[model samples]
Target: MLMVTLLSIACCCGCPAYFGKPMWEQYPATASLPAQVADLSLRTDARSENTIRELRTDVQNAHLLADDTFAGVYATRQGKTATVFGTTGFHLTPESDAEDELTRLTSKYDLGEQQVVETDVRGEHQRCAVGRSDGVDVVVCTWADHGSLASGVFTRLSLADSATLLGTLRKHIVSRD
Candidate 1:
């Protein structure tokens, strides 16, 4: 049932219509997080209403993916032999508790201090952090300027698609910034 719901959600917006049809298969290797040190970002407070308004308009320029599962829209960038993933926040009711848990776990992991920075998106403030586990690189960022919402995207650079995504994200951020 959960799979059905997820699939249904994945088949909407700009996602490939074929994603919901037959022959739907995910690459096994890409199905899970890579063997790397996982890093998480810090918790953020809500943004001002003006900031939210600005972010809403600015985010439209982001490089949005058609089949993104985390956020209906996401922006990608290239990283050091890896990829950087960016997306709109997940603010489901349950996600509130989840964010708190993530914050605690992130502190325990000593993933470095969460650095608050202004995102390329207007008015959005991002708390960015990076960590690694095994051989894979992990980055966790939360954009909380969009009200009671947070956007986060996890990325692995080992996959070819990830590499491509990283490059795109890098290009967009660098040029836009």
Candidate 2:
């Protein structure tokens, strides 16, 4: 009787131990922090009213994705097209160097080819470039004045629409003094 009880206990314990090994093996831990910190960080803000006003009017359903001290992203959708307009204020960095950083950040998207263009923004020479993605187009505009550098990107719109939208957005960007 004693031997039979011991065997039964061992069998019950053995079954769980056997099953646990496969469970652990199937779901191995592989989580690690990113090696490099991204210069751009975005979040969804549903209650914020501090983003670009023109961007909200351009699309049917507009929402603010992020609102940081130096950057912001506004997401919108029209028909089947999804778009994102991002702006970054590089006041802490040198104006001359902000263009390179903004370029690097925008390059993460699938911009096929790039071309420079003139924008309606009030600046002697603002850096405005347009590129085409898979089926969407993107426009990036950068300007420097006084000690501040500002850059904006409008993505996933038609070439004409992107250009038009950027022009409207540029009007609202207050140049640094």
Candidate 3:
């Protein structure tokens, strides 16, 4: 639901970027789940794999940016599993760009009644919500900087735990080059 037309305008007219960052830059991002993240192991089962595949297609079809990269992971620890799907793309409005993705994620999972979480992302804008998924209490967190957007589904975990884990995961999964 976003476009990259302003980059051309800025380049043509020599417009200054926000906080010295150019709108045309792609942020050079990469996402992955390591073998362990705060005790969560990377999931590679058929169901997890299929879910990630379908979700990645959704991200691609969203047409969020002119140039985008998508990544997803399902990790399990102590019998609790979570899925995180994310993309890195350039958008004129980084602050609210991820909100659409968050809404799409919650609706896709049939979530109801979300509570916003106040987690910070390097002083960038982030929105998080907690809800029930498949009768399991869970939290979904979304974060966006000038470069990237992501949301996660944490099953059988409290909001605090999900937020903390998501923060940690974002640190590892998303990075600038």
Clashing pairs in 3: none
Which stretches in model 3 have alpha-carbon errors above 4 Å? 1-18, 21-26, 64-68, 112-116, 119-123
TM-score of each predicted structure versus truth: 0.29, 0.38, 0.75
Model 2 weakest lDDT span, ten residues long: 28-37
Ranking by lDDT: 3, 2, 1
Tell me how many residue pairs clash in candidate 1: 13
C-alpha lDDT (0 to 100) for residue 64 of candidate 2: 27
Model 1 stretches astray by more than 4 angstroms: 1-110, 120-123, 151-177
For residue 173, what is the lDDT in candidate 2?
33
lDDT of 2: 0.41
- Every candidate's CA RMSD: 18.6, 20.8, 7.8
Most TM-score-accurate candidate: 3
Tell how far residue 121 is off in model 3, in angstroms. Answer: 4.6
Model 1, position 86, has a per-residue lDDT of 29
lDDT by residue for model 2 over 1-177, one digit each (tens)?
A: 999999998899987776454333322112111212122223345532344334444321321222222334544433222233433222222334335534553554444443344543222124546654455556665543223334556565554555455444433433222
Clashing pairs in 2: none
